[model samples]
Target: MSISRRNFAIGLSALTLTACNSTLGTTSNSGAPKPKGLPADLRPHLNRDYAAWVASFRNRALSQGITESTLNAAFRDTGYLPGVIKRDRNQTEFTRTLEDYLSIAASDERISKGRAAFTRHRSTLEKLEQSYGVDAEIICAIWGLESYYGDRKGDIPVISATSTLAFDGRRGSFYEKQLIAALKILQNGDITPSRMTGSWAGAMGHTQFIPTSYQSFAVDYTGDGRRDIWSDDPSDALASTAAYLKRSGWTRGTKWGRELAAGETASRVLQPQAGGPRFAVTGNFNAIKRYNNSDSYAIGVGHLSDRIAGAGPLRTPFPPDKYGLTKDDRIALQSRLTSNGYDTGGADGVLGPKSRAAIADYQRSLGLDPSGDPSQQLLQTLS
Candidate 1:
């Protein structure tokens, strides 16, 4: 969920622009094979062999009642965009500390803007929650995080991005299906190709809905007969996110989570292997994770929502070791531990039990007290 792999826009505007710097083959008029010598990370499915992929996708779209003309317009001149693949590949690979992720995604400026949005759209938001059983703060938080309240709905052409990823072998089937789904959106006369721009991975709207998520969850809250998530109307986007959560098993009238006084010196109560956190996180928290798999992402959205709703910060420190650590730094430490034979499971920055065990093993190896506190000294040692 962290944008460390990307350079996003910063400011308070109704519209934002973004550009991706990556290596991928573009669609050539002559439809030649992909040029060789490209980095493995940047190489895309070449045009020479892209026909079968395109044909398969075209068939799927046509089966969905999408016409050939719409498909052609969306796919023609589209290229194998490397930036899209890069962003997707990097989405969950690296770990990030809570503080660092919040710094990028849920800053004070974003919170202020979120609060303002909540107030400005109070009537509509209230109606949405009343109908959908979701909170306005959660919606605002999602909006702010996704596109900075509609300021930065990315400009990459979804068709090219999805098409290239489909042709490429990495998660090729998934992206290929998404590419067809996108064409179906166009064929249905839902939105224009020109207006169908989004993240390199095809996430669009104020709350970054992927093509499939949009198809499954997007709604026309304004009764416009079109589910236009790309429009300035935040209602549809907010409602859609709420709907996604609702369908994903969000429990109404319960908090996402509460801060807990996790004990000191590696208490069993604070450890991730304890099975779950002392603080009770409701099912809605899981629903947030459905949007993104990372616990840190769910926590950020939940905590930011609480903040926007005029709630205070956590009652306890998010355990000691997480202090003073940024998202990437935590990931780096986890990576080091993993490489050193400490199996942290993933490089995700959260100091889960596995990471703590790794830390303990590392400390024991170094002849230090194996408390697994994630202390500043331990971090320094790891560095």
Candidate 2:
């Protein structure tokens, strides 16, 4: 059997407590010992520290030419949100497999909705295509995928998330630059502070755009003089996404590849899989990849966009060797392999090559097939 088709695809609180008993204070001994507790090194960093980091960030933003009013307006009283950190660190939902991902991301319902949106906004999409040289479906698919056609723009404050990342020091420089860019967006008046809420990772707007992307690729598609991706009006966000694709070399007329009906003989040719998926890809496919570097993501977007435009499911199946297992069996087998110390990155039930290798190693240890194909029998033995 083979698989295919498509695939498709925060809270913070602060408390200040002050002991204010005049009589008790006078009665207490002057040399009362401080309470014994673990040192600051053992404790997590405090939100107050985040406030100080933000204070320093003011200077950094000014250095980047963001006005003080915008800096104060956006950054004032903002603190490190622990929920944001939790969300960013645990990005992938634990149970989401590649197949499951495609099921939701490239579902028939979404494609149908997207096609309707393309039709409803045909004039806007056509103008965008003419101006940006990017296809309407590509833009609409990205919009639908990123935020469900703008129904769910994120709610996390950009300043808070980016500031936390900047202070966390793991990728401080990268996040600090993003924080500065966010402030600049505020200074430019593209969106009000109240309306500028976004993802826990600070990607704002209908398209989940980072601050730099908003600055560089966003457009005033409605001619309202503001490149407002955060607004209820999706014209700007949709157009911005198209602009990005165009600038990234989107072919005006090329399709983003289709699933190939490769024969069994093609399975023997694994050497050519280095660049991308085995399916025949086009320029538009690579352009989508530039938005998100993952090949799986690009494939999902491309396939979903095609489907949205009335194309049906993939003409060919993704060979079993690709995942080493079908969707139904992947989760249980992946769980067994992961329990045995093979970290397949996740147990999302999609058997990518790593999961296959893990299955093979487990089988070899158990004196069974080493061909790396997962089966119910193998899963049973592992369990």
Which candidate has the top score in lDDT? 1
Tell me how far candidate 1 lies from the true structure as C-alpha RMSD in angstroms.
9.9
**Highest TM-score: which candidate?**
2
Pairs that collide, model 1: 27-79, 96-327, 97-327
Candidate 2's TM-score reads 0.69
Q: Which stretches of candidate 1 lie over 4 Å from their true place?
A: 1-47, 51-60, 86-92, 261-278, 318-383
Model 2 error, position 279 (Å): 1.6
Taken over the whole model, the C-alpha lDDT of each candidate is 0.67, 0.65
Candidate 1 residue 298 C-alpha distance from true site, Å: 1.3
Error of 2 at 313 (Å): 1.0
